[model samples]
Target: MQSFAKPRALEPLRPLAVHLPSMSYVDVKMRWKKDASFDAVPVLSRARDLRPLVSLARLLSPSPTPVSVVSKLRSSLETPDRRVTSFLRRFPAAFVESVGPEHNLPWFRLPDAAVHLLREERDVFAAGRADVTGRLRRLVLMCPRRRLPLRVAQGMLWHLGIPEDYFKDPDHDIAQDGFRILTSGDGVTCQDDDGRELGLIGDGKGKEMPLSVLQLNAMRKFGSVAKVPVPLFQSKGLRLKRKIQDWLEGFQRLPYVSPYEDFSHINPGSDVSDKRAVGVLHELLSLFVTCSAERRRLLCLRKHLGLPQKFHLVFERHPHVFYLLLKEKTCYVVLKEAYMAGGDTAIEEHPMLKVRKKYIELMEQSQEIIRCRRNRKPIELQSMVSCSGDIEDCTEILS
Candidate 1:
């Protein structure tokens, strides 16, 4: 038998120190640029305002709810009763006003069309349980310890297309695939089994590592995996200044790093590090069913993802990939691919989107209702209110 030579002592890995020219350290405030096409994207534009309506609809799903009961939800909805009531009245097609049987107070209930649509939404959630869990799993895998706090996951339920009952149901299927929920004195956490090296979109065993939306787009356009994809400006007149454009071009030329890969080797504040940061944001947004998220919501993820203090600036720096929409005094970061060039819609539309479109159709009826009401035509108003299923009661309110 051949004797094996003694192996040399293993050395501890050290962090790499990257050095660059002094100019790279200059601090520049990147001004936010607006894009009309992205602002006009239907889903991103309306989802914020519709969220309150949807939440109230779900609350009233079980039975007609009184204004007093809805008013108590001020803290939950983050808006006062007046605002909530105003919003409810704006959508006559989706919500019907009635008097409570017991208290005779103003009550709200879903219209028949809204009820049927909500039922279909539930069916969609049930059928897509596996997909929702998969998205959650991917999110946890991106964490440093393959663990994610329960509160964070809960916050993401709406964007992930998960039903509100998911966590409350102990028998839910989330515990099926190498995932478990651990409870302790601190709080609840969702963790995956150790030693599993899952990629963003695929397992590492595959020949091709999972590529981000940007990478795939680059490959398609360049016929190879280019480090930087050609940026698509939303507006014809919009243009980047020479200095900023040059800096962006230089930043784009940096080597691309996958979000799922090891990031410890990257140097902080370097161009490579910025690329990794961008990759992380891209992957995180891609996991969402809507491919968009509120900027404030994403701040909760920074510490867990090893992102810089000002990671949000990436959205401003990379307008081609991300779009920042300032609406209702809240900033929403939208992944452009989802709305442009037949991205998410071209591949497969999320079931929630179908429900949303139906809700939009229902909302359109409100315009007609308002038009009829403005004309002070009792005949048309009566006919419309009758169609709402509570003509006798709502007619007085509408008038």
Candidate 2:
């Protein structure tokens, strides 16, 4: 009979004391260098030292859960020292990347590429890219050599299954409701050749625009990233829009009859029902925000990429139509569904709708897939993660 005993505990987990170097230890080995903006180099350096311990914990300990890491994290936070926090964070990132494929699939591959292209276009216009990159990317880019999250995005794209290069002058404009608008170029908002970013807006029309201007418009932290493509090009018809939307609905298994879209305007003196409708609408907006991205948010961002539970609808421009805008990178999506729900054909009736909330589980848990190769995990096309986030009622590219 084979003996499958505990085997005298292969390796007992050690207190993380030796896991991190003492302050004097670090001081002797390294000095802080002042960078232009952020001073994360030191943190990175510390991560290198602690990494061996973490890897050891993984290999030798009975179990080294994220929870255990979290406990050590709390200890680091409480300690007078701060090196521990950095080690805890970077270690998890490394672990996530290391285990992503072994644990799960990734999105953001080829099949998913079409949606990402569209999203790239949307962010390029509605806001800019780098600004978004700053705020959302932090959480998503956890691992050094990562693949799980991006794989999820790629897989869904394949599963949601759309064509490649769909954003290059898309053949569908049906969603525009019979109108055409286009963006200028990718460089305008960028810091390079053109000037549409960093408050450059445009020279003369686009002047000193860097990457930050979009931050001002998008109202996001990195809104300053100036490079984005916000021009709207007219396509053949609404076929593209219809096809894309239809595909998403089927792919996501969303319900056709939206009860909330209907009752928000009824205002029948019933606060309870109104609130419920509001909640549902809010979910829809989040869905819209993330959905449009396809899998961009999940590909590069995970934590900070969520819809605000609170927002405002301002009738600043188009009369009778209020703008469902976010505080930063303020966005507005089509209010057609809401209008139709309210039994009002007048496009100008309800200009905007606002909502905010807590439970982002649905929007966050959209879909994701991960593919694996030997050393490097290959993110497949069908991988997907929910692209749901805050959505706005954005008009056409040219409105």
Candidate 3:
């Protein structure tokens, strides 16, 4: 024992390499199906070119405005002065063109019908001021800082049912209601004062929150919120492959996350994070009057909503909940449940949409005027030709 060699130093123990199962699911690429009903939503175009007519009408509400002034107000190069003038001319029922006496330039004004429609729209907006403010507040609350830039808010004016004039003096009534406008070097930002979070599920003050489309369907089908809601396909024959369907079933089984809840704890590439992204998008479209928006417009809110860099892929991945329409080279994302079975009518039509329909009806008159003018041209030319022939014959006889 005295002669025993010194015990060799124990080999350093190595930690085991634990391999965690990947929670990420493969994004199965599904073919997009065109739903005529969703495509029928008004102002589906990317540029929403027709909507500018409303703004033009408002600009001329005080008096006839020159094209030069309208051109200057155009912020996007997509809608040039020529396009604006042409669009205004197409809607003769809404816009009236006249020559200015002093400048001798074209001036556009809204007709009586359009003026009445605008007044009706104002009444609708006034009556729904509380609702509008609620939507704007929800949007601000969705942001990480509980604030939204003035430009971002303005970009979503149409979707949020906010009036353009609201920005000019936001501090008046809009800001007085649990909101404040702050100016910094970055620019103006609208911040929430109360700072309460909102969600599609759960309760507040013992009152249950409004359920989402999927939640409502789940309640209707399973008679409980715990079960997975079956997706409503765009068409009758539309069906997902076995693997895709299985993946969707698993996805639906994940605990639903409220869009307004904090997402910091969620793993970025996991299924839960994907579910939260879908929730955020669903909540966003639900707030829109049309329950749809241009894909590009939603891109601006990606960072504000805590979405991933490739967030738009959610729309394509979950085709059952959302429908992506590529019309006029513009991508529009539509909520499937918002529309009726036929997709022609909305389940819950906004009050503003009724007035908008009236404006659209007025706009149709312009096409009729063009058709009449086109049809009358042939008769007028024929009459002129006959008259010229008679004159020539009379001259020959006189000679």
Candidate 1 structure quality by residue, lDDT tens digits, 257-276: 77656688777767777778
Q: Which residue ranges in model 1 land beyond 4 Å of their true spot?
A: 1-30, 79-83, 101-104, 185-210, 218-234, 343-348, 378-399
| Candidates in order: C-alpha RMSD to true structure | 9.9, 30.3, 10.3
Cα deviation of 187, candidate 1, in Å: 13
Candidate 3: segments with Cα more than 4 A from true spot: 1-18, 43-47, 76-82, 102-104, 170-172, 184-231, 341-348, 377-399
Report the CA-based lDDT of candidate 1 relative to the real structure. 0.66
Model 2 deviation from the true structure expressed as Cα RMSD, one decimal place: 30.3
**Would you list the rank order by lDDT, best first?**
1, 3, 2
Clashes in candidate 3: how many?
Answer: 0
10 residues in a row with least lDDT, candidate 3: 390-399
- Please, what is the TM-score per model? 0.77, 0.16, 0.77
- lDDT (tens digit, per residue) of candidate 3 on 143-200: 7666666677777878877777676764446544455545542243324333322221
lDDT of 2 by residue, 297-373 (tens): 22232212221122121112111121222212323232222222233221112101111010111112111111122
Worst ten in a row by lDDT for model 2: 350-359
TM-score of 2: 0.16
TM-score of 1: 0.77
How much is the lDDT of residue 202 in candidate 2? 18
TM-score of 3: 0.77
Alpha-carbon deviation at 331 in model 3, angstroms: 1.3
